[model samples]
Target chain A: MTQHTQPSAKALVPFVSVDNMMRLIHHVGLEQMLRDLAGYVEDDFKRWELFDKTPRVASHSDVGVIELMPTSDGESYGFKYVNGHPKNTSEGLQTVTAFGLLADVYTGYPVLLTEMTILTALRTAATSAMVAKYLAPKGATTMAMIGNGAQSEFQSLAMKAICGITSVRLYDKDPAATAKCAANLAGTGLNVVICTSPEQAIEGAQILTTCTADKQSATILSDNMVGAGVHINAIGGDCPGKTELAAGILSRSDVFVEFPPQTRVEGEIQQMPEDFPVTELWQVITGAKTGRSSAEQITLFDSVGFAIEDFSALRYVRDHIKGSDFFFELDMLADPDDPRDLFGMVQRAAR
Target chain B: MTQHTQPSAKALVPFVSVDNMMRLIHHVGLEQMLRDLAGYVEDDFKRWELFDKTPRVASHSDVGVIELMPTSDGESYGFKYVNGHPKNTSEGLQTVTAFGLLADVYTGYPVLLTEMTILTALRTAATSAMVAKYLAPKGATTMAMIGNGAQSEFQSLAMKAICGITSVRLYDKDPAATAKCAANLAGTGLNVVICTSPEQAIEGAQILTTCTADKQSATILSDNMVGAGVHINAIGGDCPGKTELAAGILSRSDVFVEFPPQTRVEGEIQQMPEDFPVTELWQVITGAKTGRSSAEQITLFDSVGFAIEDFSALRYVRDHIKGSDFFFELDMLADPDDPRDLFGMVQRAAR
Candidate 1:
């Protein structure tokens, strides 16, 4: 393991672990990173046509699902391997864990590999706020965050950074989760309110976010709870048969989604019929479609998360970690002196 | 960088780099390792029904194709990221590169990550020899290895270890390739014969292995060149529109394949009609179907490489590297002291 015994340049890949990712976020300031990631997500969304898109390939077991989300922009390729098992938290494991890789399409060589568990949180929140930037009611100042978990603080901070939301009202079924979220957001420049009920949380809020992590379709917000002129960011209902809002709420709102094909299956729109109309968020970002037409029009950003966001997140990390002590080189590829004489490389390495 | 800052057990993943893979292969002896890997491949094939199978998810660009081959037993999941760009060798790069991961199904924790560029060569050869054990002509002693490249030496050694082949006649379109193959196999004990043409290479040989790296449907061996009572191991024609053997040879032979759906699209059988008949190699290994019915009945093992083979290879590496100094720990996962408090873990790391 001497410094002189380093892997060849072709064999090395830059890798960011969770510890480094955390440090990177803190070094850049969490709010600034969220703002920076939102800009990247928006840029990718604006040029979404250049991306090779596919529905996330998922393998579902009885308890959870493992998925591979891959996309490319002709120059570079990225894919994320993520799993979700709500039951994992009960066993003292995270319900969601992920890792991703970015590769050069020209040579098919991996350039960067990083842990995406923390990055997914940042990107998911940034994506929600990005879509909300285009679809939220103008001059929005408050958001009701129903699920107070690992994502609640990030979502609130992202909204504050991107959409100028000054306050977030938090409510979770578990009082301890609300306590944790409230405690985390204490000095994040967001006025936080701890509410006992979902009904109270959404009171006088112009933006309502539902991020309850449940595998089944439990109505966190029934139809009556959703009012007009508010942007509802539904973040937790990302799997089939799992959703946050009631069908009636979706029926009344002008639903905007990242990808219709995916949102119809995994987003809150899954409650609607297959023919139900939803606007693609990219169109709004590209100015191809209208976001919120009138002051009283209800708009819902059905954020199920997509590969492009992860692609942009990986791209951002790949660029941001440069000249920074956030990533190390991993000797992941085999680069023989003579590529064809791989056996000879092995023989020589033995000596 | 402090010695006290060790990653938690849950966050640590075993990583086998390219250098370590080469060392591990030499430590176990290449021929014995090939024989051992063949045993694992055969065992997985026997219980193939227990695996979650899917056609490989592929993204094909104009230059090359990148694929994710994923499969899982109920307890563990494995996937290999592989790329194929036939023109890469011209630029002093390997045409194919790969890495893989094995994760626990229950906790979604990565158990092992390794460079598969070398393991792939070993597993591909072992798989060929394993199929040959079930399908090759009995008392086979000489193998005609056409298209001597990175895979040639491994394939020759595997045939010798698993099927009692004592000699190999090597020929490639390029004489330098044959010379390189012969030089690499000098001390391997298989009497090597350097031939000037494919016709001369096949003389007095019972196994014909074609592993040319052309990305087109070039017939390395035409119908006239392939004879009776020989097992044709076509390894190079693995993508769509790529085939090593002529169509007439496949029509005349009892073609056996790793996975019928995939082989019909990527194997030598891709040249045949959609409904062309072929037997699954697993069925032959499990005795559900017959292999090598008569000495004169030409048998074709159309191997396009399946996820199950990579799954078995990763499994073998995971088991074989135990208590061996071939791997080190990678802090790839973010294991917060409180799983729900991932943000809190990041917050504490700053202090």
Candidate 2:
């Protein structure tokens, strides 16, 4: 009898845990990592037509929703499993948690699996700042960060790293959240101001980022508050029945979104009629359409998040972890000595 | 600044790797575990109406396909990531590999993560045998196992444990596969016979199971090869453009399927017309429909596998790991003392 003691190397997959992800972020430097991730996001956007895009598969319940966002670029496939429960905060848990996987399209074998809660934060911010690079007003140095939550600091730093923003004004309905955001950015080289009101946060800022955590249609930015030549990065208004910006603001701004069919149901544009005109961000990134045509024109990136951004983030992580000790091999696949003898392998394990 | 070291308990999810799963199967005893898993699959089938079912989301490449199958039972959500690459065998890789996750729908937090490659085999065999228990002829004891591949032994043992089978006759196109299967089943209590031809293997057998792993359509069983009163468990004719049984066989048999919408595209019934009449297996389990009506009736279970079976398998693992040292806690989620201070959490980790 031949003894099969250990699984083959093919059974192992690289897994990046949350602790390792934080370590990798620090090792790469947060700002530089954000900048690098933004480059990947921009590159993917340029080739978005090649991706197999679909709206996220979501299972909605009364308290929250669990979603699977999957996309393939023909060579590799990636998906992120994420859950959003606004009520989790009350129970001392994160409102969102995620993990992602990347696999080889040829062999259908997973190449990487990583915790994406922190990575999602990084990618979302990078995607926002990347879009702003093509749509925000020239020489924009100030951002009005409304709803200072878990995503606020990342958004602020991403803007500073990618868009050269030097100042961030933060505001949230909860004063403690605003204070936490201010403290987190204390020595990040950016001038951080804690604002008491949303109106005050937007004062004299050329970029307005609204990322409230509410699951309802609360107007964090009214039409009157958003001035011309400012780029509105509206990410908080994701999912149905959740809109942070006013309908009039969307009516006046030249709205750009990450996939129109999805944005029509989940983004801020959901409040608009079905036939409302909006440009796909991929077109703008590819130079097929004009962006920021005039200094006084309002550009709204109605960002509801997309699968391609996660695919690019997965690609970046898979590439970065090649020569780094940032990931560990997980015995996640069953590789029998002979592919047809899975039972014999299990039976031999008892020996 | 107060120092926050280590992630909170809520941030950790229990992960059962392949080694631990093998250990778990051996600890519980293989046949007993099969019976137990069959119970869970049967229980889930009885309450099938309570489940949220959707066709698997597949990403097809020229060489293979990757899929995400997700389902929820209102309180708990489950998903399995699986891939199939038939060409992988020549490269010494398994044709299929899988992993699954179970999460709490209320809080939207994952509670269990496990390697499902082995579990999927167990669940697939258990589901087949459980359905045969209801549909196979009374006092059935012999099964002709066609396509002696990775799933053959598991199918044989599951039928022995759950359906009172005492003998298995195995045949495969590759004689080496048949030799390996016979060698694996040598010490088992059941009478195992190795046959050269599929016809010789099914002589007087009360059950027939075909599980060939080819991506293209191949007829492993013809209409004249089958007789009345035998249960046919056709499992490998899954996915589009792949099938195993002749259309004449399906035309003469009363077919039972897991999910009609899915089976129409992936099951052996894919060769059948779209409006072809077939009873759902869940209805038979719930006593809402008939199983085997007479000794001369041929019952064919068109098993393409479904998310609910994977969900039930996940539920079984979660329950079985409660007080056992079969899993390790993985720090997969980012937990901050303040849910809104994720950036602060990462920043503090640097210190």
Candidate 3:
């Protein structure tokens, strides 16, 4: 009964807390971290065909939705548990929160657990910027950052770091949100401008990113406001009945999506018909399909987040956390000395 | 930028480690905890109509399978991440490992995270015994426990605690497994009999519980071994292509199942036709259907563990952890004083 008290090393899973994740970001430097994450996202996108992909399993309620997004690349499996409650901000809670796990496919053991609320923001921005690198017009230097909420700063910084953007035009329906974003980007070396309307935000910007937090289908961008020869990163509308771009804008733009099945249901393309012509970003990354063929062609990355992005982010964190103090091990799994004697382990723990 | 260093209390989730879970089991007393867990399982089953049920999302490889089981009763949401690798035991790892999370349905915020490896074993036994109370022959006292693995001792103790079982006859193909189960039950009050064959194990027993760990269909119980009035609690055949009872035996018994959609794919009934008649255990608990209509009827509970039972176990752990130090808080969620200023929160952490 008294044989074993402590679980073996295999029982422990490395866990990255929010504070530690923030520390890791700072230790690596924010912009550099964003670049590294973008690199991982790009690498995984190149091998996208080798992975197992599924549309997120979602539980929708009147107030919000909780979703499980799982994917595996034959060697490793990853899943993210995330919740989106637009009304939660009024109650002093974040609008979205997330955590993710990576497991070994062969042993079916979780190797890493991490706080993904911050990481999701990083990955989403990284993904957008990475896609824009291929789809954006050459010599792009300015980005119109509409919907200056939690994701605004990340998108702005990622563009500056990855896409050589030197200026960001910020606008949101809520002035306070724009102000918060403006303050966060004050010393980030980007030319941050506060605009009152979406039209003013997109003026002279080569890239336009829409990232509002509304739950309904309010068009943040109309067709009349958009000009050709620009890359549009629309990330705000990520669920059914929620969209940022008008149907006219979608028709004018050649849409790019992470995954078509998921994009059709939750992305800006949800406004379009089910059979809407769209390019998969992975195909573009693999050079099987062209990203942007002409300077006057409108390219829109309909950024509904996908499971593979999270898997890539998880892999990046798992790799970076090694030989570093950014995470602590959690005694999460039960390990018995005798695999078949789990009852004996519990019985001995009593002593 | 230096305003907030630590996350707000809302961002912290209480996490129960494996050690703490074992401590909790001893604190509540093993028998009493099993009884309490069975009570919760019964209560949830009684109101199962209110729950959002889904078949587990599974990721399968050549070696093993990892599954996510999620369910919500509208007020609270729960999900368990579990893996089953039959070959893991040969490599000195557990055949199964699990962890779970419970969140608030209103805010979509996780409230509790706990190791479900041990909890799964407990809840599974509790659920079997609870159902056996209704379907097992009235005044049943002896259980024939075939396949003495990690789950055998828990099943034996749970039946003793909940169903008033007085004796257990144990048998396994491996003598070491049978010996391990017998040794773990030495101090338990039930009269334990070690049998060399499955036929000898069922001698004079009213309940037969088969819990082998094979990943394929292996008939531990045949039609000829069963008598007219005995109850079968077959819990081993819990995945695709895995069944413990012979089809002939299934044809001779009235099968009861938890979540017919799942049981049809993973339970002993996978051997039968899709249209095979089986009673939903929830309906029996809610008095919508009859259970064990007569003393001479052969009742079979094809026990493929369901999400609702895991939900009940999560609820029990959450309730019991209150006012106790059985868990520690993990900084899992991102919290900001200004919820719209998540970037500001990360920026401030740099200080």
Candidate 4:
């Protein structure tokens, strides 16, 4: 709306490039980024009722999936399009990648375009850690990390920052992935142990994390593998027909979710009934409900990654980054001396 | 996909901007762009059965409309979000502005982000003219244009190109718009006559084009003003309750629509019955059905604008524009070397 004195949010748009974001990560250590992002994600989730919500619109393909997750609060609007292709790794590609838009709701003009690939990992870990903060027992020092792949280190770092996790037992089908995770966490001050199986990883670990990327239903955590007073953070089984926990694991826990309508179809709770009683975490954060009845209660945080987390991540990036050289300046918004003269723009540009 | 050694249509994704598009316009001329785009739109319509079509998903606001119109052909996919706020003109903004995404259906990856603000104007004109090519009478020479605002010139140019319109009668509630339309058509070799009233504009004209931008159900064309053998190109009355034509005008005409389901909701036929008989223009273009039946038949092209037209415009731009350091290189797709190592990208970038 440059043509008139209309309200514009152009000044708030943060343009963070992949390289610039990489630089930002280096300047601020990975541990700090994960912890800070978790704080932001948690703070936003606590006030979740103030925001608008919607189920994601997904366009799925046999090889991959692309989705548009949009939400607004009558002030700002954000949407993320992410893709997941389990077999992309065989072709030397990342199985999940994303980009997002942050716009001003008042003007309906996009103010930011960000590479959310790295940010998604950070936010996912932060969200999991936040859930653990409320549900996990005090002095929880050891975490069982199933799927020691791309998301393993973030989980370990967040738990260490928020839940005082000083030790981690990691297990994955690919031993190389576990080895990589161990090496990455070596200087981070956490004691990492490579376990042979999910059972071995769960031994004496108070917090269990399942972040596998299998496209089909596979029980990484069964009832036998879980224990009392342990909080389960299930991450990887995010779409229909894809799940991690066994039915027995879900049947024995006080399940909690971000948005119930979507979680029922895509969360680990997809194995459960339609009338399943699950708590929206916002209520817990807002003190309207409780996260754990007691330390002995089995609390399962069904983490299917909601749109609100992305909104918070985008807000965090916009707030933390200030240098403007890394962003693309767009003429996407149409400006006429008069809004009625849109046709005049083409004519002028033609000249 | 550009990483592939062997080239395929799926491998080359084009990203065109307003600047790049203007260069295309300057090189090929607007008339040719309209003509070529019309052929492209017609060609796509002929293959209508190959498409995956749906009515646009709209998010409405008090001031304007923002929508996502998505369609696919199992190979390529496209979506566009455009807003229209007629009162936005006094603030020096265009009543309608838009941008859209073109993606690969096989990978569900966004392949292009083109400026549909300008492209929409082009496609709207082309579709109107192409429909006129099929439905307007033989040797149609004059067009009466009501509500000569943003879309007025497209109507004039399209009718001039396809239906051999040599003279146009123009009237708008606002006089400056008519002046602007007259200035844009200068030296275009068509006779442009400014009429003070809608009745004066429709005098003995073979084609009547209505492109108003009112938000109410204001009748701009009465039944008595429209006679037999007069093809009406209804361009503006798209959203609910914003129609320009009286129901009597639609009742007397054989309606041709882009998609019947959508046209029934957003076109002039919104006030009509659910069982109202209408022909999908694509069927008529493919000769699976009929267009103008006889010399006395009146045809109405209910042009609410569709996504396939944007797909065709993007395809045309992709074919015409070569990236020799004159385009926006968007990060619409992820090209990770090892898809499984998504976390490593952040780590490596941190380095």
Candidate 5:
């Protein structure tokens, strides 16, 4: 029975879904996994030259945007099909959902198909915390999270686990969202406070995180609300017309982005001129550029997402589930005895 | 019993490999599917305005090329991952292999994942024959095929069935490839003749197709070889550095393409001037532009493969596999009752 369902020549692809990834998080412990994932993301950025990168291909519609993010490291290739539709929550669906493939470059056969809905959140938060570790001051302990929506708790947990953040402040347009975030953060050895406004949320925080999801340009943080020596993790301003921080915030800080060309179009830097002088995060990780200038300087990580993060996360899932029950085999590649006989496989199937 | 596999909201992504796609073709019969898929592709082209049509995104490497072809009609979206590696045959692989997905636009959930390697061959041929129905001379009979590789048989059969072609003149650099084509076309009832050169193949032919898989500027057809009123289906010149015909031929022909912006980059027209006039194929299919204006004026359908053809083929597969054993479900979207409870699913997986 097992012989019939499997291919003869190629390796079987493994299917990893949202539920399985969640189970993986639970099995490995989210705190440990988040820290581990942050390490992987940082390591990938350190050697960015291995990747052949391009700005994501995005198709914008009236309601939302769908994008294809493709990258290859000459040895392996990966791409994700992701969509962002803020109105989906109103229909009891997620604002974002995704799945991706990792393929071997030699044979061009897909080896893994992963559900990225859960992994994207984990990787996004891990990316934010990883950047904070580089740019934030030593012994940074406080983080204020605005937009206490679906991504809020993830932001809090990732910062706490990866960047040693022990205190968090939360605020949102919906008080219930804030309350839920606070409840989720309880018993994590972190002090959580619910604030009323964005100003109050960012008052004395060392790291200010904004993970809001909306279609319009809403300023989650204003210039006056920010202070020196803070690392702003703006995760929501990723679409062509959507942004989180005000233009003044970008001007006052050293803006670091995932990919410069894409950041100029979709990141908060969209509000700035083309020559606004933004540094790519990989350059900082690779020691090609400095991340933080001084103790009194403000830093902004205008991440519109990139392909390297997914590659790291995919490798992480593959490594973690190597001996686990979460693994599944898929017929993803053609296994031919004589590869020239691909047509014969069809003839056999018909017979 | 059903929940033994951990019913947390993880996605299950089903995949059909290249071998399985060929099996689907053999199981469904290529003749019927060619007829059926042509109808679907033509129908989609008729409603061309509804699709969000942008040019394909490509990543070119030293060895070969990888492409992402995406399109959405608001309600549904589709894209294909295809690679064109001309030298892959030396490594016992086909020159082209493809896979694609169909997803709901609102949810970003992939409803189907299919092996598109074999389907691409069928769709490309059917699409060529589809455009030729309207653009070629009514009841065109003889066709000259200049390249005979893996894609040769499909093009011959599709044009024979769809355009009433009664004869095919075959030519290739390797006689073995030509013999392979003649063997595949043995029982198709069309008069198949092996020609020594491109000059002999195009003599007195109504439709001349050039699909040689070369990676450089190759002059497979010159201006003198093509006669008056001949409909040229230029299918092989689809990359930045690849071309099939001499510029002198395009200098005299009325060229049409799937999308002008894309065709100029990847079609035979890439060799022509920036302002070279070309009409979108939809205009001819919708009867908005007069097709084959007088059998005396040379017509060139600069056929760079388009996303809409893959979209149509995917739709046909999705429809035909509804009640068949070929169907498999993929966890492409995170299905959570509460979209914000992705963390909870991870937490429960620990149990």
Candidate 6:
């Protein structure tokens, strides 16, 4: 066999670290990045029919669940490895952690690998706000954040950037969490209000986002507390039996979801019967279905988080990191001079 | 809100690169590593009922298929991302490439991440040899390796290490591939012979291993080519519509498989009926099923490669990387002082 003189290609995959993710978010201001991510997600949702869709493959344990969400757009493939363990926070660890990769479909080589815990937060918020862009009442300026945990500030900023919201009311079962969220959003140019009760928080709000971190079904928002013409972004009801809104709220609202098959199993719809009617969010984004039919119509965005959002987020990071110091190359693949001579390469490496 | 003085404990994941994988293999001699990996795989198989089992999630395109194989053993979870594009070799790329991760099932923190392109080759060969040790006829020595591509030398070395094979005869449709395998195994202390045809390669050989890399079901070995008292290792027929041996051979031999659900779809047994009797190799390992029934029996180990093997390989690597420079830490998770204050963590990082 002829030997090539070039050094091993040793396929290098660009890796975005947690620190660099923060740097990238800061480089592009937080609100603008949220807006930019919303655009990418909207573009993908508009072309959602072209994507390979599958419910996340999950391994559930007694205490937590780890899932692999994979999707492809014919040209590129992406997947996120994420886990949800609400008890982790009590043990001094994040309740949710994630990382993802984008690979070329043709060559099957990974192009980007990134920490997705921060990005997931951004994309989830952006997705909620993007849906609200179509579903929320016109001139909506205030949002009631019922669970001021990790996602409260991001959801607020995204709504502000995407839907022109100017203020947010934060409330949580734990006052410390509410204080931390209000403190974090102090300088984000949005009016931050610390509400003593969920009902008080939603008193004059046009949007209500529920993002509590718990593994059980809890009535974070009751039906009586919800008013008409308000868009409810339900994010915490992501897994089976872990819903935040009362069933009466979903019964009265024209619910929308990312993917029905997943939402039926994981989202707030899990509380309803299998025949529960929900609009595919893509259809609403594509204008095939009406988002908010009238000023007094109730709209709820039941988000379980789909793979395409992560795919779009990965694509955004892949595109933005070119020639930037926000990423470093990882020598991750064995690219032998002769692709068929992997053994020979290993033998020579002994020298 | 009070801020903690400690640094963010963003979960650090350890990564093993291609270069580091090679170093690790050499640090522990190649043969010993194969033997050690086989032991881990065998140990896992013995307790296979305790594992979380599912068929691989695959996305197939016209050119290739990318798959995510995940499995958990209650304590740790492991998954491999692998792709196979047969035409990739003609374009000077590997026909297969892979990487994998192992994570803690408790906290969902990634424990180890490593490039599995090289490791897959090693683990595949080890798994084949380990199965051969159980089913090969007594006193088996010489083995015939048709389709001498990337996996040929490793299979030969692993057979020598685990199954006590002393010599190998190699043949490929492309003589250049045969020559490359022969040259690579020159100083490996095992006798290697280059043959012009599959017929000549199997002469006087007790084990027949076929690993041709084609996407279609082409017969590399006809039924007449097989004799009694031999163990056949079939590796290339790992996807639907891809098979190496003639159907007559499968009908005549006692078949053993790993994960029947996956093997029946991807292995050579796809040619057989749904009820075709095949022994699960794990059952044989645990003494629940017979391996080699008699000296005159023909046994075929239909090895389609399963998630459990990858899990075991990952477990072995995770155990062996302790106090070794073969890995580096990756800051892959976002850990905040207040777990719910991820937004605050990013805000603080801007300073």
A103-203 in candidate 1: lDDT tens per residue? 99988999999999999999999999988888888999999999998888889999999999999999999999999989888887899999999999999
Q: What is every candidate's C-alpha DockQ against the true complex, given to 2 decimals?
A: 0.62, 0.65, 0.71, 0.38, 0.37, 0.62
The residue-by-residue lDDT of candidate 4 on B215-314, one tens digit each, is: 8887899889888898999998898778989999889899999988888999999989999999999889999998998988889988898878878887
Per-residue lDDT tens digits for candidate 2, residues A212-294, read: 87889998888788778899999898899999998999988999999999999999988988999999999999999998899
True contacts kept of 2: 0.82
> What tens digits encode model 3's per-residue C-alpha lDDT throughout A5-33?
68789999999999999989888998998
Worst 10 residues of 1 chain A by lDDT: A1-10
By TM-score, how accurate is candidate 3? Answer: 0.99
Task: Name the lDDT of candidate 1.
Answer: 0.91
| CA RMSD, predictions in order | 1.5, 2.0, 1.7, 4.3, 3.1, 2.8
**Worst ten-residue run, lDDT, model 5 chain B?**
B1-10
- The digit string of per-residue lDDT tens for model 5 on B1-351 reads 013233333354455655466656767787778888899999999999899888887766777877889998888889998877777777776667678888777666577888787788889999989888887877689999998877777888899888899999999988877887787688779999999999999887889999888899999997788778889999989888899999999999999899888889888888888999988888888999887889788888898899999999989988887766665665556766567666655554555
Better of 5 and 6 by DockQ: 6
- Deviation of model 4 at B38, angstroms: 1.8
User: Where does candidate 5 chain A have its weakest 10-residue lDDT segment?
Assistant: A1-10
lDDT, model 1, position A13: 91
Best by DockQ: 3
Give lDDT tens digits, candidate 5, residues A1-351. Answer: 011434544536787865567667777778888899999899889878888888888777677778899888787788888889898888777788887888767656677778888888888899999999889877889998998877888888999898899899999988978887787778888899899998889878999998788877988888888888888999999988899998998989998998888889888999999999988888998888999989889899998889888888887877777877766776655544433334434444554
Residues B1-351, candidate 2, lDDT per residue (tens digit)?
223357788999999988889888998999999999999999999999999999999999888999999999999999999999999999999899999999999999999999999999999999999999999999999999999999999999999999999999999999999999899888889899999999999998999999999999999998899998899999899999999999999999999999999999999888888999999999999999999999999999999999999999999999999989889898888888888888988898888
Q: How far off is residue A168 in model 1, in Å?
A: 0.7
Q: Model 1: runs farther than 4 Å from truth? A: A1-6, B1-6
Q: After TM-score superposition, what is the CA distance of residue A208 in candidate 2 from its true location, in Å?
A: 0.6
Scored by lDDT, the top model is 3
Q: After superposing candidate 4 on the true structure, give the runs of residues whose Cα lies further than 4 Å from its correct spot.
A: A1-14, A322-324, B1-14, B323-326, B331-335
Whose TM-score is higher: candidate 1's or candidate 4's? 1
Residue-level lDDT for A193 in candidate 1: 96
TM-score of chain A of 6: 0.97
lDDT of 6 at B176: 94
For candidate 4, lDDT tens digit of each residue in A1-351?
012122233322344655556666667777788888988888888779878788887766677676777777667677777777777667555677677777656556667767787788888998898889888877889999999878898889889987789999999989998988888788888999999999999999889999899889998987787889898999998999899999998888999999999999999989998998899998998899988888788899998999999999988777776553445555555565555555665667655
